[model samples]
Target: MLKKVRGTRKKATLGHIRQETVYLAIQALQKDESLSIQLLCEIAGIARSSYYKWLNRKPSACELENEQLTQVMLSIYEKVERTFGYRQLTLHMRKQTGKKINHKRVYRLMKLRGIQSVIRRKRAKYVRSTPQQVAENVLNRKFEATAPNEKWVTNVTEFKYGHGQKAYLSAILDLHDKSIVSYVLGHSNNNPLVFQTLKQALQAAPGSKPMLHSDRGFQYTSLDFKKLLDKNELFQSMSRVGRCIDNGPMESFWGTLKCEKYYLHKYETFQDLKKDVENYIHFYNNERLQAKLNGLSPMEFRNKAA
Candidate 1:
């Protein structure tokens, strides 16, 4: 009956936890009684040889190097507010330390250290709004470009501040190097917000006739917006109705922005939100490295190509 009760009392436990518990028990027993290691091992259900091996083991050179690398990774992870996954962490590590660290090693170390990127928010579906005028999908999801300002993608995203007070961010992203060309944040998702974003981009890069692509939103399809694009000698490309993937790179930038910054914190004031948005865009453009860019930031890649 006692054995039955003992069997019924068993609970599942982790291997390391069980090992630590056995070591503790052995230590306590050794303090009061001179028990042989083998006896203690037998009682603890561990091999006496294994106990001695663990007691005498020293960290290998590889282990020590891993420990140092883990510390470096933790520093980078915290510095970036834990926004990087293993691949980005690996890139940053190699660049910062000038070490050829493998991404798989970084993945293992991150797993062991319980380090991970910030949780990403699920993408929201876009509502198909009626358009005043629509252009053909000339860009046709050709996201890659050979030179700066050769292709641009633009979109407007909504954010909420105090008590559901909404703000809209309209921005254009250059396809060549994944850099944000220009951005405007306002309280209304109106035509001017998007128009200003385009004007800023055009003013920044005058005489650059890029194919400007956008979703079939009211702002993008308006007659005034079309006239502005025509006046600048820019080709206007609109995503087909109900096909959000046609403007995929622009959509991806929004996902990256919200995942890395906006979703991580709450903003009680509009000013604070706006400031954070500006800071994040600057970081995205100047500091944050992309793997596809060979561990260079967006601006770095652009300047290198130039």
Candidate 2:
């Protein structure tokens, strides 16, 4: 009769059995000094042998180390609002501790603790412009540049907000450091948008005669656009027709902007969207680290070069 009762109790607790549940059972055992070990184990759905093993076991060295690291990670995650991935977290840890830390270990710790970065998905870019009146693809998929302002890529992207009113963002990216040299936001994606962006880039670095690259957009092919580049004595290059990949670095920038910043929040007004974009661009330029830039921000990379 006793054995049958024990079996029934064990069966009842089996559905709720877990490591945490076992820990609670241990606490319950301590509170009730008169409870039989066998009866307690039966109620916990654990064998008497398992209970004894757990009761006497000590945490391993690895477990202790992980616990310590977990606390450190929790603090770091909170500091960054939990948006950093393992790669950035690894860098942040080293920067915080002033010691070299292995990224793999950080990855392992994040996995074990169920901590992960905010994931934002990338969107595909739409095709723009006709092929006629275009320059040759002189940039030719050569995205890397050894020095600042040696090569520049420009593109226009649209942001729709507030009853589908569109705002155009025209910007130039330096291939050397992946920094935004200049940008303009306006209601229209016109020649003036691209022209003003170019003028600003030249103003910022007047000495650097960069080879400016862009897709064969109407603005790029416009007489005024070509005249402005000629007046500045800067080289003009365009991507191949129907091939956005030829100008991949600029395309990549657009993808990154949409994924990491734009897509994460909602925009109720044009001003609201513009403000967030401005903030995000500043954050991206100064705070966000790029893997290829030796885990440094764009401004940091340029500062080092300068």
Candidate 3:
């Protein structure tokens, strides 16, 4: 009669027992004095033989190492706010621990842990504008440069903070090392904002005549902007109307900045937003490693080349 009652209870509870739950019950047997081995096995819909086998089996060396590596990956994942995918995380883990960890292994471990990088938000559509005049597409998608300041691309991106207030970021990227030569944040995307960005770049790299490329924005097409470029003897190049990819490198940088940093937070004040933008740019130049640059940051690549 007792055996019949036990069978009925076990059958009723077995439907709810998952493999994960069975594992948990096995673990609990070690800590809970009231959980008898036989009862756990019955409740988990597993044979006493299977429970004993799992309990006596020791983890392999590879399994133990994978557990440890998963913990390290978690630390890095949180440190970067999950901004890095498995590839970048692997590079970072190798640098920090000097362990020649394979990226494939890292990818497998990250998958098991359900750790992943953030998804990038798609950028807004480009508004085609008819300019009175535009410079030749002198850049012609020749994005690579053999030396610093040889080819430069400039663009302005907008950000919002606190009740629809907008901030404009104008910056120049040197194609040689992908470094931001100069950047300016302003309340308005006016001619002055772009001019100041240009002025700063000119001052930063005095006597360097480079091809400066930009989109057909009003500021970039202005007469004043042309005069300033001519004064510095810079070759002015403009992207075709609605063709953002003409300045692909510069657009790529913006996407990186937005995906990795700007989109991660909300700012209540312009001051807070500006401070974060400045910090991210500094990190990008100094700390963030690039695969194309042989795992060096932008500034590192530039300095090594120099």
Residue 285 in candidate 1 has what lDDT?
Answer: 97
Counted clashes in each candidate structure: 0, 0, 0
User: What lDDT does the true structure give each of the candidates?
Assistant: 0.88, 0.80, 0.86
Error of 1 at 207 (Å): 1.8
Task: Evaluate residue 238 in candidate 1 and report its C-alpha lDDT on the 0 to 100 scale.
Answer: 89
Clashing pairs in 3: none
Candidates ranked by lDDT: 1, 3, 2
| Residue pairs in collision within model 2 | none
- Residue 156's lDDT within candidate 2 is 92
Candidate 1 C-alpha lDDT tens digits along 225-272? 999988989999988877889999888889889988898889999999
The positional error of residue 247 in candidate 1, measured at the CA in angstroms, is: 1.2
Cα lDDT tens digits, model 2, 136-180, are: 788899999999999999999988887778889999999998998
**What's the true lDDT of residue 299 in model 1?**
99
Q: All candidates' TM-scores?
A: 0.83, 0.75, 0.82
Better of 2 and 3 by lDDT: 3
List residue ranges in candidate 2 displaced over 4 A.
1-84, 117-128
